[model samples]
Target: MDHIIEAIASALNISVKQIKNTLGLLEEGNTVPFIARYRKEVTGGLDEEQIRVIQENYAYQVNLEKRKEDVLRLIEQQGKLTDEIKADVMKAEKLSQVEDIYRPYQQKRKTRATDAIAKGLKPLAEWILTLPRTADIEAEAKKYINDKVETMEDALQGAKDIIAEMASDDAQVRSRIRNSMEKYGHLVTKAKKKHTDEKKVYKMYYEYSERVSSLANHRIMAIDRGEKEKVLNVSIDFDEEYIINWTINKFTKKRTSPVNYLIDEAVKDGLKRLAFPSVEREIRNELSEKAHEASIEVFSMNLERLLLQPPMKNKMVLGFDPAFRTGCKLAVIDHTGKMIDVSVIYPHQPNAKVKESQRIMLDLLKKYPIDIIAIGNGTASRESEAFVAKLIKDYNLNVSYTIVSEAGASVYSASKLAREEFPDLHVEQRSAISIARRIQDPLSELIKIDPQSIGVGQYQHDLPQARLKERLDFVVSKAVNRVGVNVNMASAELLKNISGLNASCAKNIVAYREEHGEIHNRKELKKVPKIGAKAFEQAAGFLRIEDGDEMLDRTSIHPESYDLAKKILKELDIKEEEMGSASAADKVKEASVKKLCETLEADSYTVKDILDSIAAPLRDYRDQYAQPMLRSDVLELSDLHIGQQLEGVVRNVVDFGAFVDIGLHEDGLVHISKMSKQRVSHPSELVAVGDIVKVWVYNIDEEKQKVQLSFLQP
Candidate 1:
């Protein structure tokens, strides 16, 4: 256990005490976001990312230890467990190393080496290695050429097979070969014979070769997907002769002896027949796992940014779900995201009822005091944008519209959760409401759907489903917890992500709220089923009661700290009613953290957190992030000219670059090279999913409806 803690500390570059404290907290059912936000002193101020890394690495180390125990016990049961082999297994840092040390002792099916041993030629195989330089190999072979072994050739071949297996099973030899392959290997891919490049999607990879070390994570995932689809054949190749010579040099002791040539032949045979294939597979798997982790990290970060998009609070929104055949679905949601009205307008092709659609839209605008229009960026969005633009101009409506990504709207609209939430509404109507609600509160609405369906990732479908889901779930948890949920208005889906809350507990909370009235205080939460003391301890800080009697209940201060918070507030002469007023801010700033800690009998960290919360009770962390671009006008692809500068919101960020929505039907691509004049390793370094960036048109392909943009402006 101590060694595992030490290993985690080394991997994360943190103190051993910090890791131990964090592990203790984690073992006690504390979540990563909980540990990060609430246990600052215990973890030495480690943030959520650092805590998650420690947690993940500790799990891996624990699994490695379990595997080591299993290997040791298996080898002991086989009666082949020497002290040296046991020490090697015990010292193994990774599962692969432990497996390598246990390879020879593992029980196996019949093979050439096993057949030779069964034929009574084991002594001859061992004797060949002990032979001197002048020893006659043929004389020894003849001695074993009795009953089962018909001839000298058969005896010698059997001995060679045994030698080959021995060389291939050596742990050190396999490790060296695997390391060399990783260092010097080139991964190459080619078009398969049966596949054609009609779409040219895999054309660049048809005859592509790149050093294994230099291949980017995105390219690796792309190649893996193409290979899985059978559009390309992929293989890793390296200097085989070098590997063979290295193997020989490591195992062969006597270079001038006649047996030396036999050992050399066995080494070459082993590499070609067994070791190379096995080692190549190991290296590729290792590289793929690394790529998978990196891709998941990028996806997690992007998802976090998208989930934390600042809400357009206190605004009545009109959600426009664009369509082609069916008319555009429209939903009017009030400031609190309650559906006030719903309608359908056909402003696009096949119907093209522009005047009629305009009349309906203008009437809805007059009926409801709509503050913003959120058009779904799908289907006939451009036509809808044009119609809205003309209506706003002719009617001189005092409102603006922003294009909202509707990637997962259809999926969410048809989901079981959506059905439960809006049982009476159609799928398109629910989608229209979702489009509007996402703009008002992205984290709440987006959490209702699967994170993978949110569509901010690269090759999300190709990723391991369990691992990807786990990672995305963590992202949602962090985002949801960061912005505390209002217990009154939050749906069960949003409440489920709160720390220490699950589907059952969240459902119970909603049920309790429905049976009674809105929960008005932290004490009332205990009455909800499954929310015992421990669960309340973990979740109370993240669940807010907006109009509650206790002001701290509305803020992020945990319930346990209520006494300390009250003491600090009393010491500062600040009233609970005026806790967030400017006068309270002045009192908090004027009070010394050291003096408050002394007065409250608490630590400085706790005092500072209390003071900060008092200054800005119920502060939304999403306010720190960039808000979506609310556009007063729209642009078209045809209206773009070369070098024309425009404002765009980064819709998605990938390894190669970013896709920006410049108020057009199709998003423009800002390639990585055009992201900056200075060298940047990734597009994320320059922009994130919600960043509003400035770019100029560099190239346009009208036939393909692709727009190439450059963030580097003149």
Candidate 2:
């Protein structure tokens, strides 16, 4: 435990006390958001991201410890566990290192080495390994010759096999080889003759070789996928002769030994036959694991940015799910995201009833006072967008339309949860509603579907599903809790992501709300089944109640802090009902956090958060980017020209670059090289998902429908 704590502290560059305190809070059932937001003093002001890192590292360290114990026990059972070996195992930092240390003592399958040992040639192998200068190797081998060995040559071969196994199993030897390979190896890949990719997705990698130390993570995943699909064969190449010599030096004490040639042969055999295959796998797996982690981090960041996109609040949105064979699905949602109407219009193919469809769309727009049109970016989207843009311009309609990613809307529409939510509506109607709600409040609507299906990240399906889900879920939970939910307005799905509330507790809250009407105060939350004191303690701060019994209930002030808040307000001569108003906010902002802490006998961190909360009651963390890019115009691939500047929303950020949506159904790629005149390591340095940026068209592949964009000015 102490070792784990110290290692975590060093890795995170945080103090041991902070790590210990944060771990303690986590063990005591406090959620990451709860610990970060409320236990600021306890964790020495660690933020949610830091807390999450600490938690993840803590779990890894615990697993490493368990593995260490297992390795020790297994090695002890073999009766080869010396104090030195035990110390080495104990000092091993990673699980891989532990396994490397344990490999020699581990049980093995039937092999030439085991067979040689069984033939009573173990003593000969040991004597040869000593590399005696004047040893008569053939005479020693002759003594071991028997029915199983057959002759002196056979005995020598058996001894060499045993020596090869011994060299391969040495933990130090394997570690050195792995490190050398990782530092100097080149990842070589070649396409198969019969398995050509017509789309040329993997064309660049068809004949490629890059240093293992220098390959980008995205390239690794790309190469991995190509290898997996059998389009390419990949291998790591390095200096095998150098590695063989290094292994030989471990056993050869005398350079002029008569048996040195035979020992060298055995070492060479070990390098080629046993060590390289196993070590290459270890190096590649390590590289792939690192790549997976880096990719997951990228995915998690993108998902976080995507989820936290500001809601288009107080707008009557018309969700238009475009299609060709079937009529386009349309659903009208009010300011609060309630579905008020549902209809379909056949504007695109088969029907071609443009006049009739135009009339229906215009009527719906006028009927609902629709503020925005959220067109789904899917099949027939461009056509639908063109139709909407022309409709707005031709008639000079007040509403504007933006292309909303409809990646998971259809999936959500067909889900069992959707069935339960909208039992009366068809799947298309549900989809329309989902698109509308997503624009209104992305986090709320997005939490309903599987996050992996949201399509915000690269290679999400290739990632370990459990780890990906866990990380994406954490992103959702943090986003939900960061922007406090209105208890009366939030769905069970959104509520389930609240800090201490699980699916059952969230359902109970909603069920209780349904039976008893709008929850009037935080106190009423305790009445919900399965929501006990601890749950309320962890959750109350993040659940808002507008026009509730107490004014602070609508703010992020937790229930337990009500007394301190009341005392502070009383001391400041501010009325409870006027807590969040402009005058009260000004007064609270003017008050000294340190002075208040001293007067109220509270932690300084808590006092600061309370003061900030009082200044901006029910403050939305998403207000930083409160508006998404709404377009009254649309573009086509043919309309694009080199150096034509356009404003776009960054859709997805990958290692190489970001994909920006410029009102076209297909987004353009802004490669890292063209992002700026200066060199950039990754696109994330300049853009994140949902960032609105100005990009110029650099080039176009009209036939392939690919647009290369640049963030640099013309």
Please report how far candidate 1 places residue 19 from its true position, in Å.
Answer: 0.6
Best TM-score among the predictions, by candidate number: 2
Please, what are the lDDT tens digits per residue for candidate 2 over residues 329-424? 999999988889999999987888899999999899888889999988889998999999999999988888888888899899999999998999
Regions of candidate 2 where Cα sits further than 4 Å from its true position: none
Model 1: residues with Cα > 4 Å off, grouped in runs: 76-87, 146-148, 257-261
**lDDT minimum window of 10 residues, candidate 1:** 249-258
Instruction: Report, for every candidate in turn, its global Cα lDDT versus the true structure.
Output: 0.88, 0.89
Model 1, residue 314: displacement in angstroms?
Answer: 1.4
Top candidate on lDDT is 2
Tens digit of per-residue lDDT, candidate 1, span 510-534:
9999999899898999999999988
